[model samples]
Target: MKWNPQDIETFLQSKEYVDTAVLPLLPVAFDSEMGQAAGMSEFITLVTGQLERQFKGRLLLLPGFSYLKTCEEEKLFTDLLLWESQLKESGFSHIFYLTSDLFWKSAESRLDGSLIWIPSIPLETMQEAQKISVVESQVKQMLTLFTGKWHEKE
Candidate 1:
């Protein structure tokens, strides 16, 4: 479920079933004059929206974390760890980050959560059929990873 008032109400009542939090880590490069950058950001949001819908009852989709693409990512580590702590305190045992950015995967060990890096798919330029095909394919892979983690905790 996405972070909103109605979802939070439901979440509070059934917190046990909603043990996982999915955070979309997006990097916005304001300095980039590349035309595709904006499209990439939109694609990330749509793909993550699909994933959230697929895993609705079990996952809480938090508002995405956006940072300057050119900044030092190491500087965000402490902040991310603190966010993890707060999520744990709120009863989410599993915190997973989904991103098209590859940087987080390399720093996963240092961060306090599991990071899944999805290589970028240019959805903005694709035909509807093509976009659906890509989103569906990626969602399957994401589902597999999510399920694997869920079962592991059993």
Candidate 2:
């Protein structure tokens, strides 16, 4: 479910079944690498949206957790851990952090949840049909990962 009033109401009503939460980790940069930053955000945003639609009612798609591209790694990890703690306390059994950033891979071992890192594919030049096709393909791959994690807990 997307993070909105309507979805939140539905989620609250059936909170037990929606035990997973997906948080998109977006990077923001205003310098020369701004284009890359925007690409990462766009790619992950599309992937996460499709992911949420495919798994509607089973997981909550929270807003993207945006951070400066050059932010200190220690601080970033600390903040993310805090978010994970809060989600766990709120009853989420599985929390997935979706990102195109490579930095999270190093810290995945210490994370309480899973970190999914997919390299960014620039969709700016793709046609509408092509973009949808790419997004759908990516979602299909993610379905396996998500289901595998869910099965592990079973």
Candidate 3:
């Protein structure tokens, strides 16, 4: 569920079933075209919203991790591992890191969480129906990844 007040209240009451957390690792480069960045953010949000809806009770959608352009990669990588450990200690067994950032693909092995990498589609240029279709397809792939992780314990 999204990190709103209502959802968080519900999550508190049913914390036992909410074993997974979805964290979006978004890169915000100031040098990039504003419109392109906005479109990328929108596409990521769309897929994330759908994923939350599909697994509402089992997932807590955290705010996106906004990676700034000026940050050091080593520092960011260390911070991510720290976040993973803290989340696990707080009772989330499965921490899924979702992103369209190609850099994460190569760094996945070093990360302490599951990584869901998808190619970024320019949502601003897509038609309404096309956007829906793309989001749906991406959601399905995410579901498969989540399901695999869920069943790993069994």
Candidate 4:
């Protein structure tokens, strides 16, 4: 599917963060099968371009990161730490990442359960609105919580 975030005008127009919200778009074919990296690149480029068009000046479009096919647990552990540090050092002090193992006909979890504890948060996007809407809602909620907690403790 075409994953467009800024095209979610209905959702964005409802919030005041439309101008400063940076949306990272990861377009995966949720309906079809996964592991199709060839098609994933095209959507990544398209969504990056869309972010540039929509929120270039006021927002920041971060690169999407992915990894798979780890035969050992040590490599996965190292990669997770490195990625988290990289993102954190790059000023992503807080992140709401989605770690899911879709498909498998509900037989079992994907990725062989090795990277189940890869330090990623589970999120249910693509359900109510589009996945982008999920991101938008997350940002809004985070900002709200941040401000509320800041004032409450202050």
lDDT of 2: 0.96
Model 2 segments more than 4 A misplaced: none
Better of 2 and 4 by TM-score: 2
- Candidate 4 residue pairs in clash (backbone atoms < 3 Å): none
Which portions of model 4 show Cα errors greater than 4 Å? 1-35, 63-77, 94-154
Best by lDDT: 2
Over 1-154, each residue of candidate 4 has an lDDT whose tens digit, in order, gives: 1125754444345433322222232324434434443244333444344434544333334455454423254564465456656645654433322223332124223221111111112233235346455445444434444345324533
User: How many Å off is the CA of 70 in candidate 3?
Assistant: 3.3
lDDT of each: 0.81, 0.96, 0.85, 0.38
Q: Write the per-residue lDDT of candidate 2 for residues 22-126, one digit (tens) a residue.
A: 999999999998999999999999999999999999999999999998899999989999999999999999999999988888889999899999999999999
**Candidate 2 — number of clashing residue pairs?**
0
> What TM-score fits each model?
0.90, 0.98, 0.92, 0.33
- Please tell me which predicted candidate would have the highest TM-score against the true structure: 2
Q: How far off is residue 31 in model 1, in Å?
A: 1.7
- Name the Cα RMSD for model 1: 1.7
Separately for all candidates shown, the number of backbone clashes (residues 3 or more apart, or on different chains) is 0, 0, 0, 0
Tens-digit lDDT track for model 1 on 1-154?
A: 8889999899888889999998888777766534445555666777788988898889899998877677776677777888889999998888998887777777889866789887888776689999878888888888888888888878
Q: Per-residue CA lDDT of candidate 3, range 1-154, in tens?
A: 8999999999999999999999888777777555555666677888998999999899999998877756898988988888898899989989999887777888899977899888888877788999999999989977777899999965
